[model samples]
Target: MPGERTKYAWRREILATRAQVSPAEHAVEAAALAASNTRLTGVDDVVCAYVPVRGEPGDLRMLDALREHGATVLLPVTGEPGPLSWARYEGPDSLRKARYGLLEPTTETLGPATVAEAATILVPALAVDRRGVRLGRGAGYYDRTLGAARADVRLIAVVRDNELVDRLPEEPHDRRMGWALTPDGGLRQLGRDLPVSPE
Candidate 1:
């Protein structure tokens, strides 16, 4: 684990680096990620995923893949700084720019607890460590909402290949992920099975 100041610095550096990626690189990686097969699909379960904005890896392709394969995908509906609400994702046509640089659905909002139905959740991360420590954009939205998800829900972080590091600054409240999704690697288990205590 790392102190708050260290985590903040890491966030700054990682984001700066991500911002430097060229548009050509972004398109290529995004395409590869979308085309990569994750054995996670075809479960016929509710899966929670986020729409990537900025230079984040994977586009709406991940959600589309899930929906086309088997899962009934749910996307985040942003609100105040606590547990996030959700909505069924129809497609990119349904997303409207929301607060905090997020592209959210215009569909009916569902409560945070609706995440309990998810069998897997694809989280956006700047980086993730082998220990399953995830570094988000510092808003803490996922941290709050994750507690509402079923304990067994496969929490997976989505990032570029190099973004997977050996370790990261982690706090007690920072939720852990069970796996990572990369553009080339597809799905790689973080191998951290730590019990998620109620936040």
Candidate 2:
């Protein structure tokens, strides 16, 4: 198990840095992030993504781009703190306020197992290291949920360019991201790839 204290420290520092990004800068980054994400999916592909809240990278446009590119987008239907259930994302209007200030799809839930349908998963992360260790918010929702997906699924961590860091503490339960999607870096493979760059 990784030290919770170290994870908490990393979360605090990254969030503090995210909080400093101005709205204008964030919007520009979001657009670029959305553009890059479009390359990952195509018609009929099942994609699991999330609504970016707080200072997380990208925005509704990212989801929209995926949908417009003909992918079936699924957003998390957050309930208690276990594995997250998923629902088909119709559009911005399809979302309703949910627990933790998240916007979830009003469409019928496809259940937690629906994650298995996705070819790619755009995960929300505070930071990700070259070794594919992802630093997420303290909640373990993703760690629990991702374990159910197919081993070959492309687990992509969505973060700002600078949020891609040198290293992070990892717990045995922590799910490793296979790729990192950044505003500038686009899609970069992790782990064996020593120098991260767009794929």
Candidate 3:
């Protein structure tokens, strides 16, 4: 029997099979790499980062580095089906538990209009291909959000090294990444900027 698989199944299988590493170590390396790359570019001012939930790629280290570099941070707040609201990330203290295991900011909530002002956005992905196409959590939150942002905004996907692969099933609306930050290899351009084949 050819059984059908749900989107949740794809997300679970990939996440379960991903390399298991100490969160602290991965956070340290990813933070240093991201910080270095952000400094070199000189364009990243306001960054969008996620609050670690369900053991995603980055921990608080990435947020800390961005703040230390004088970049304002924003986090996603669950909104309607196709849009997301962002709130200025003041600190860990400003977070409150939300649905889907996501910790969101409780300070000042902002509308989607503010996303355009961000110079860079660090997106969370389940898997990303060499073409920079990202497979997210399947809610289509980022796809809709990124679609509305300015074309020049740097959309970087943060993932474990192995998760950044050569190829993945892509949809037309899937947003591409300009860079990928991994613990092992530091920061590397994923698709548009580099000619490397997808792993």
Candidate 4:
């Protein structure tokens, strides 16, 4: 089992640093992040992403870019404390404020298994190690959610350039990411080459 003490400390350190980023700099990074991701080639599969809140990098523009790339984008409809349900993202105008300050689509709930249908899953991370270990908020929502995804699904963590660290403490329940998409680097595959490719 994973200890909450280390997780809480990492979250605090990462979030405090992110909070100091000026709005102007954050805007520039967000733009670059969107542009970099949208330019990725051969991404036509359904993309599962989140509507980043607070100091998390990227915005709904990233989701829109996925949609424009001929993908069916699914955003999370957080309910309770277990696996998350999904809903198709129509556009910016359809989002409504929900609990925890999240903006979710007004579309019908598509159940948590919807994560299994995505070829790509973009997660919000405070930091991710080169070994693909991801450091997320202490909530554990993503950990439970990712447990239901297909084995071959491409798990990508969204973070700032500095958040891609050399290592992070890992636990048994901690699901590893296959890539880290940063504001500066766009998309960089993590872990060793496994002869497999992602959409």
Measured by lDDT, the strongest candidate is 2
- Candidate 2: tens digits of C-alpha lDDT, residues 1-199: 4444588888889889999999999999999988877788768999999999998999999999999989999999988889999999999999999989899999998789989999999999999998899998888899989989988899999988888888888889888999999898788889865445433
Best-to-worst TM-score order: 2, 4, 1, 3
Off by over 4 Å in 4: 1-5, 40-44, 193-199
Worst 10 residues of 3 by lDDT: 35-44
Worst 10 residues of 1 by lDDT: 190-199
Instruction: Give the lDDT ranking, best first.
Output: 2, 4, 1, 3
Per-model lDDT: 0.83, 0.90, 0.73, 0.85
TM-score of each: 0.90, 0.94, 0.83, 0.91
Writing each residue's lDDT as its tens digit, candidate 1 over 12-83 gives 888898899999999888887777533565558788888888889978887787787777889998888899
lDDT of 3 at 107: 83
Tens-place lDDT per residue, model 3, 48-123, is: 7787667676667677677877788889988778677899888778889998888998888999877887878888
